[model samples]
Every structure is written in structure tokens, then in C-alpha cells.
Target chain A: MSIMRLLLVEDNARLASLIREGLDRQGFAVDWCESVAGAEHALKINAYDLMLLDLGLPDGEGLDLVRKLRRAKLMLPILILTARGGLDDRVLGLDAGADDYLIKPFQIPELAARCRALLRRPGASLGTTLIVGNISLDTAERTVMVGGHTIEATPREVSLLERLLRRAGHVVAKPALEGALYSMDAEVTPNALEACMSRLRKRLNAAAADVQIRTVHGVGYALFAPVSTDG
Target chain B: MDKAGNRKTGPTGPTLFRQIALRLSGFTLLFAAMDVAIVVVTYSSQPESLAQELLSLEAERVQSATDTDPDYLAGPPGADRWSARYIDDLGEIAGASVGSANGGRLMDWTRRERIAGGYRITGVRSVVRHGKQHWLLMQFEGDGIRPYAPVILDEIVQHVAVPLIPLSTLLLIFNIVAVRRVLKPLRQAEAEVDALDPDNGFHRLSEVTEPREVNTLVRAVNRALMRLDEAMAMLRSFTANAAHELRTPLSIMQLSLDRLPPGEVRDELQADTQHMTRLVEQMLDLAQADALAPELLEQVDLADIGREVVAAMAPKAFADHRDLQFACHGNTIVLGHAEAITRIYRNLIDNALKHAPGQTAIDVIAGPGPQLSVRDHGAGIADEDLPRLFDRFWRKDRRKTDGAGLGLGIVQKLAQVHGGTAMVENAADGGAVFRVTFLAAEPAKPA
Candidate 1:
């Protein structure tokens, strides 16, 4: 698989380097730009898989860059990485055509997870295989493998498992899971999504998968690799 | 208290209209008094001369009577009671000359002297009647009535004082209308001042439509407001800069920490960083609560905001092993800042999650009215600590809680900015309930 390349536009050198180091460990190649001018120049020279744009830059506003790229019909997914935590700023950034927003002081793991989630969307450049720990699900083949062995699963279980795998290690809210598992007009009972989640959990566990499905009671579910006992 | 101070203390003080009316009445009264004084002085000083003129007038009347009819003067006295006598010379009268001569002729030769009970005015005129030169004497006796003083006073009362009553009343009415008309612009400016929202620095009292005096005052107030706006803008920008400057380095530290291997020390450092982040965010929220402008407010559904906030915080509550539930009833439309309203619910739920024990339910209820309340199943707040719950930076057992105690204070401030109230009370069912009520707005009709 080809490496995922990201263009990061941030003014603070220390923060930019730290983000680069974090993303590099997550198997992403990051190109850092310290100003809007540098970012624009880099965008012209490099075809990036995604862009992490900061709102405040030395040369210009990052919102202006997002608008310019969108006006030029660039479909690359852009995630706003900034310290502007105001709700108005968040709405303004999203309305200016950025794909997502992450406030500063965020965990690097969370940032990488958000990037992966954005890339795994339909028509995105990411591959069809979703992996967390030893469990892997292939969207193109509609199959699940645990430790190189196939696991027979129902279509509904596969759908739930795919949604969980997409946002692995993060709590996926119950409404989001329901939206993924049911049609809009489907009259779903309150326990219907929980029932599906329970089935998926049982199937993955029965296949001796290295992942665990944890229920944050009354909130949602999360998938995480089991803590190694050897540690 | 002194009379003036006492009047000022209550509603008994004279209004601007009444004060102007009274002043006008006082001026009219002074003019009336001057009218009376002029009448008295003229009547008292000129009586003697007036009497001499009357005597001369009688003599002339007799002369004209004789010209018309030779026997007219020889006839008896007329109704005016002037006794006429013929004398060879005027030296018989026992009185001094009281009239002046003009052109070497005694044009008015008259005298006045005190009689037994009154004064007499007598005049002598030499004339030829039937070709005989003789002196004609005419005398007038007046009893000591002295009715001029009372007459003058009565006339003044009838003409000057009586007329002045209605005159001053009309003046008073005119004055009231004039005062109101002159103050119309000031009243408008007063309304503008009352309507000015302190959070909205753009509001200014109008200077164009006011009178010159009021315009000066309004211009001064507008200048002060301009200065206030500058200060507020500086404060807001400072807050933004502080957020950026503080959060950037914190983010770097968090990123570096995430790279450390899993251990107790790493976990403890992560916790400390998380606490610092929360503190910074709360401080920023406190600053923003003061900056919610009137333009940012709108008709939003408290139920909608309540549901969204509950759903968003449910994960945190669940991770802490506490159940979070939301309930809504009826229309909960309110005039509010939507994001601020969301923060209110978030803070209340966060507080409940922290205070309530694990395995307990935290219920968030949004109204039958424009109110949202959160009830947590835990030991209720102590009676003594309830009063300070909403105070900024005040905490109960500060060491026990991880928060900086700014959550409730922000809730209260945001509620107040929306023209609402936030209240806390210990519930009877063994928990504390926090309720925030907002100004209700009319629901929109279906299109």
C-alpha cells in the first residue's frame, strides 16, 4: 500500500514538529508548512492525501486557504487543527468547506483516529481494508479475518463491525451506530442496535479475535485491542 | 430629616412641570402687586390738584351757563351742589391761592381750606354781565369720606388680581406644554440609555435629533461608550490571544506525553495536563460569558439544546459509571444565545457527574416551560453551601473536586445575559437539582 501523505500548515515550529512526529508513528508522511504562503506553495508542488490546516498563520487566514482550494474544486479532505475553540469559530471553519475540526490540546491518538475516519469514507483514497489489532475487515470483499482465519458473520453484524472498526479505540455514539445499521424510515426498537452490537461482539469473540468490544453503558460502544498480559 | 431632603426621599418632590408652573404664577402675582401699588400712589399724591381742577371746571360751567342764558347763574344750585355768589372783589375768601397763573392772567384762581367737618374748594372769576364788571365766586364743600384708598384697592382686585387668576392659569398650562415639548428629545435619549445593553458596546445615544444642550450630554455619553467599546474589544482580543498562546504549548506537551510508554508516571502526567486544559477552557468560558452580545441571541428551543448536550455528555457520564438520561415535554422555545445555552446544560451535567456517585442516574429534564433542570442521585448539597454554589471560584471541599468551580458561575452569567435565572435547590428525593429558566419566546407557526 502507498503511504498516506499529509500537508500540515501550522505557525508554531515546536507544535508542528510534535504533530509530525506523532503522525509519522501512525504511518503517515507529513509535509509541514509554517505559513499560508509556504502551504500554498507546497500544495502546488505536492499531491497530498489530506491537509491539516491551522486557522491562524503568518501570511493569511487558513479559512481563506480552505475557500480558495474549495473554489478551485480540490476535493482533498481538509481537517481544521487550531486552538480556536469557540463554537462560532468551529461553525465558521466547517461552513468555509473544511471536512472536520479538532481543537488544540488534543491527544495525538485521537487526531490520528479522526484522520483515519475521514479517509475511510466512501470515495476517499484509503484502501478497503479496516484493521485494528489482529482483526481485519475488507469492505470490497465483505469479509472478516482474525489471525489469518475467516469468520462467518451475518450482513448486519458485518455492518456494525465495520462502523466500530472505522472508529476503533473511540466511543461511537449509539445514534451514529443506529444510523449506520438501519435505513432512515426503518422503525427501530430501542434495543435493536444493542442487540446487533451484542451479536457482533459474540461473533468476534467466538472467532478468538484480539479485539474487545467495550460498552460505555447508556452512551455507546468502543473497540480496542486487549491489553497484552506480557507487558 | 430636613424638609428639602425629606421631599427628595420619596415621591412627594415637585416635578419639573409643577416647578415651572409655580414660577410663572409667582411672576404674574408680582405684576399684579405692582398694578395695585401704582393705583394707590397716583390717587394719594394728586388729590389736591385734582380738587383745584374740579373747582375751576365748575367756574367754567357757570360762565358757559351765563352765556347761554343770562339768568342761568342767578338760578338755584344744580345737582352737583356748587354754590355760586357775586362779589365785587375776590379778597373776601379766607383761603390762599392754590392754582398757578398763566400769561399774567389768573386762568385757575382757586383755593382750598379746611372747614368745620370737611374741606372746601372755592374759585373766583371776574366777568362782565349786562356790561357790569363783577367777580363770580364758586365754592364746593366735600365731606371727609376718603373713599379713594378702598376704591383703588377694590378696582385693583376686580381688574388686576381677578384677571390675573385666569392669566396665570393659562400661563401655567402653556408652561407645562412648553416644558414637555422642550424635553421630548431628552425623554427619547433616556429611553435609548435604558435600552442600551452593556454587553453590546456598539449602542450609542443619538446626538443628531437632540437639542443643543441635550446634544452635548449625548455626545459626551457617546464618547464614553466609544471608550468602553475600545476597552471591551481589547479585553476580547486579549482573551483570544491568551487562549491561543496557552493552548498551543499545552497541545505540544500533550502530544509529547502521548509518545511516552504506558506507565503510572505517564498516566499521572496526562492527568495533570488534562486538568490544566480544563482549567484554561473554563477560564476562557468565563471570559466569553461576559462577551455574549445581544445580536447573538435568538429564539432557540431549550429542549433541543438540552437533548444535544445530554447526548454529548452521556459518554463521559457513562465512562464514569453514571447513567445520564434526558426528558423533554412541550414547547421550550426561549430567547437565548444557543451556544451559551448549550454550555449551561453541559456544565450542569458535568457538575452532576462529578458529584453523584457511580451507578446513579443523572436526569436532565427540559421543560413544560422554558427551563432546563438537572437532578443527580447523590447526597444533596449542604444547606449552608447552597448559597455560594453559583459564586465564582467557590467550591465545597475544594480538594475533593477536580473542577475550578467556574462551571456554575458561567451558567449563572450566561443565564443572566439571556434575561434568565439559574437556581439551585436540594431536592427532597435525596439529591440536588440545578434549574435554569430562560426568557420564553413565541413558537414559530408552520409555513
Candidate 2:
């Protein structure tokens, strides 16, 4: 499998560097640009799996590029990363052809989870069933199995497991995971998504799943193959 | 500006131009009607006098004729166009000419009698002709001598028509121009009031050109504006203070935590900062949405906004094994701020997604009430919880911490600011439905 490459278009140098380092540690290569013009130049010379676009740029509004790219019929998934977290701004970003929206002061894990979700789209050259170590999820069937033994999971748990397995070994954002585990129409209590995740984790461990889901403090959840310390 | 003094309904009844025009027209019509009545009265009161004049002329003509010839039964030929009659006191037809009236043969002499060419004038007189009593009734073409008042009136009208018609017209035009000029300052005051912009800052209405009465109104309006300006300034400061005091530390902590190595400790710190940041941002948004003025409202398509929000959140819904659908039958337009309306959709959709059962489809529908309603398929909300659902920081389960519990409160506030209402109710089968209704926009006019 080839490693996914991403383009980050943001004006803030510090935030750009932090996001770049974080994604680099997540087994992806990220190319950073600080302006719309620079980002355009990078896109012309190289291919990227996704582009994290910031709305406010030095030269112009970032949405202009989104409009231009959509006009050109370029099928690249553009995720909007901006300090503008207003509801209208989110709608505008999505209407302007952005695939995802993340407000400023966002967590690296959430950003990573969004990138994973976008990469796992059908045309992104990724498989349907997500696998990490011995655990696998068939997104089509909403099923989860470990060590070739099908584990009993509610549909909600399977959906949650699907999200964690897709971004295996990397922190999956809590909000993103919650979004994945329940319908927005559900009357979920506060942190109820977390409660559901805890139950799913226990079920996976009870089934002796080789992969273990780890909570990354306030960040999110990560699934990784446990180290064999018996040697 | 004493409220009791301004309660005079007469002052507000009509414009000066209208009042003057109406009075002048009414006065002109009254004079014209009086002139007509005078002519009618004068002509009607003089019929007896006209008959007496004709009788004396006939007597003179007959007496002279008898002296020339005592048996004269008619006046001399061509003496006058009027034909005279001679009758004895016993009321017998004494003599008659080819067309002369026979007075003794008349049935009623008190009233004017019709003759061949014109009317017959009858008069009773004992004329001593040959020492005998005789009555003379004159029949003539009295059409030649009409009533005197009509002739006088005709003369009067001819003399006055040229000048009076133009004079009244000039009076009417002058009244219009003078009234308009007098009211110009009041109109100027009205225009100034219309142009005042509260958003631009404090602008006192101009009292310079306004009449004293209008100046009072200007002062009252300016006073109200001052109160609004003060309130706006306070709100501005509150937002500024909140921004400076809360966001700075949150930003600093988030940036500092960014440098921490990848671990559970750093992750927890980051999540806490994220939560705090969300709360601060939402608080500010709620304040802004609540304080939006009516003038800031805009025309927007509710369905298009719904579709965009649902499309934006569809991935999250899909990941949760739930379906998000937007159903709109027709144009759902409303007058509202785009930001406030968008927040309404975002918060409602978030609530529905979080509260409903897993794998349930959530539908965002543009309803016939010109409202946007988000319907879920999970169990409906409890009757007790419905009332407090929109209260700040109120939650059915306090232990759940996905949100600061301000989302619904902000939704209600935003709806209220747009002159709309937010309502929640249970669907027929199950699940909770959240609805926000707005003022429908005027339909698009044809070009």
C-alpha cells in the first residue's frame, strides 16, 4: 500500500507546523503552504490525497480556491480548517465544495480522524473493510470480527469500531467518533457517545481481540496491536 | 411634548393642501347655488305684476279705439302684435276675431290660460265704455317678454363669468402651492426620520427646519435613539470584555498543550481546552444572535440552508449508521439573518443526532407552516423535560458532557431574535420533532 500525501493550506506558521508534525507522526506525508497562491502552485506540480484549506489566507479568501478547484472539476477532497467556526461559515465552506469543516484551536486527533474518513472514501484507493492487526470491520455489512471469529456487536458498536479501525494506531477524535456512533437525531446524554465506546471496548477485549483500543487522554481513541511482552 | 395636548384628532386628520382645496371648492359651490336660487325666487314672485302691466296697455288701446268708433270690437290693424278682447259683465262672447282670445268664454281666469300662439293675460276691470262694464283679457305672444330676473342673471353671469372662473381656479392653485410650501418642513422632518440609521451610531434627528410641532416629535425620537445607543454600547463592551478575558487563556493553553509529547496526559489537556473553546465560542455566538436587530434581517431560502446543513452533517450521520434526509416540497423562504438561521439548523440537527436512537433516520423537512422541522425516529422526549430543554445548561442527563447544554438555548434565542418561535413536540408514532418558524418572505415579484 502507498502512503497518503496531503496538502495543508493555512496562513498561521505555528499552527501549520504543529499540524504537519502531528500528521507526520500518523504515517502520512504532509506538504504545507501558507497562501492560496502557494497552495495552487503546489497542487499543479504534485498530487495530494486531500487538502486542508484555511478560509482566511494572506492573498485572498480560501473559498475562492475551493470555487476555482470545483470549477476545474478537480475531485480532490478539501477540508476547511479555519478560525471561523460560525454555522454559516460551515455551511458556506461545504457549499463551496469542502468535504469537511474544522474550527481553529482544533485538536490534532480530530483533524487526523477527518483525514482518515476522507481517505477511506470509495475512490481514494482504500478497501471497504477496515483492518488493524487481527480486528476487521465490513462497513457494507456493519460487522466486526477478531481473529477470524465474528464478535457479537450492536450495530452502533460496529459503526463505532469501524471509525476507530479506519484510523488505527492514531487518535480518533471524540466528537468525530460520537458523530460516527449515533445519529444526530438521537437523544444522547452528554458524553453518551463515550459511554457507548466504553462498552464496545469491553466487548472487544472480552472477545480476546488482538487489537486494543486506547483512550488518548482528552484527545480521542486509538486502536493498536498490543506488544507481546512474553518473550 | 405633552401626550394629552397632542391627542387632538383634528391636527392629524388631513394635510393642509387637502383642507384648503376642500374648503375653497365648497365655498365656490355655495355661492353658485345661491345665485341660482335668487333668480328663481325673483322670477316666480312677479307673475301678477306682469299681468297688470299687460291689462293697462290693453285698456288704453281699447278706450281709444271706441272714441274713434264706438262699436269697435277689435284694435286697429297692425297697432300691436298683442290681440285684445272685449267682453260684457254677464260673461257672454260679445265679439271675437280670427285669432283674438274671447275672455267671456274662459272657464278659469284666475290662472294664466293657454292661447294659440302664447298665453292669455286676463284682468277684471269695469271700464266705462258707453257707460257699460267690460272685462278685458289680453292674449299675446308673451314669449318675447320673459321673467326679468333671468335676463338680469344672464347679464350678470356674462359680466362675471370671464373673471370669476379664472379667479376661483387661481385661488385653488394658490391654496395648493401655499399649503405645500407651509408643510415642506414637516415633510423634511419625516424624511430625516426615515433616513436615521441606528447601526451607524448616535444621530440626532434635525430639528432646524422642522415646525415647532414636528420638532417636538423629533426630540422624542432622538431621546429613544439615545437609549438604544447606550444599550448597544454596553453590549459592545460586554462582547469585547468576554472575548479578551476568555479566549486569550484558552488560546494560550491550547498552544502550550500543542508542544506536549503524544501521550494520554497531553490528549486529556487538549480535549479539555477544546471543550472550553467550544463553550466560549458558543456563548459569544449566542449573545450575538440574541442581540441582532430587526433591520439586520435578510431574505433567505430555508430549504437551501437546510439542504446545505444536512449535506454538511451527512457524513457524521452516515458514520453513525443513520440516514440524514432533507425533504422540501416547495420554496421555504423567510426573513432572517443567515448566521442566526444557520445556527438554528446546526444546533437542532446536532440535538436530534445526539438524542435519538442509533441507526434511526433523521429527517429535516420544510413544512407547510413555512417552518423547518427536524424529526427523529427515536423515543419522544418526556413531557417534563420539554419545558427545560431550552434552558441554559439544562440537560436530561447531567452526566453526559458532549455539549455545554447551551446549544438549544442559543437556538431558541436566535429564533426569537428573528421574530420566530422554536417549538418541540412528539411525533405521532415516536421521536421528538424540533421546529423553528420564521416570517415568510414576500414572494418574488415579476419583472
Give the alpha-carbon lDDT of every model: 0.78, 0.72
DockQ of model 1 vs. true complex = 0.37
Give the docking tier of candidate 2: incorrect
With a 3 Å backbone cut-off (N, CA, C), the pairs that clash in candidate 1 are none
Alpha carbon lDDT at A155, candidate 1: 71
Tally clashing residue pairs in candidate 2.
Answer: 24
- On the 0 to 100 scale, the lDDT of residue B10 in model 2 is 32
Give the C-alpha miss distance for residue B274 in model 1, angstroms.
3.6
Query: How many angstroms is residue B380 displaced in model 2 relative to the true structure, after the best TM-score fit?
Result: 16
What i-RMS does each candidate reach, in Å? 3.5, 10.6
Per-chain TM-score (chain B), model 1: 0.67
Worst 10 residues of 2 chain A by lDDT: A222-231
Q: Over all chains combined, what TM-score does candidate 1 have?
A: 0.75
Q: Give the fraction of true interface contacts kept by model 1.
A: 0.41
Q: What does candidate 1's lDDT look like per residue over B1-447, in tens digits?
A: 255753424577887888887778788879988887786676567666545545454556667676554224532222234477667655667654534224222334766677776677666666666788666677666654342334454558777878888888888878888889878888888778777765655688877554688788889989998998898889887976786679999998998887889999999999889988888888888778887765677899887777667656755665565667777776689888777888999999989988877678888888878898999989989889988999999988878548899999999989888888999998887999999998888667788
Residue B25 lDDT, candidate 2, scale 0-100: 82
What are the TM-scores, per candidate, against the unseen true structure? 0.75, 0.45
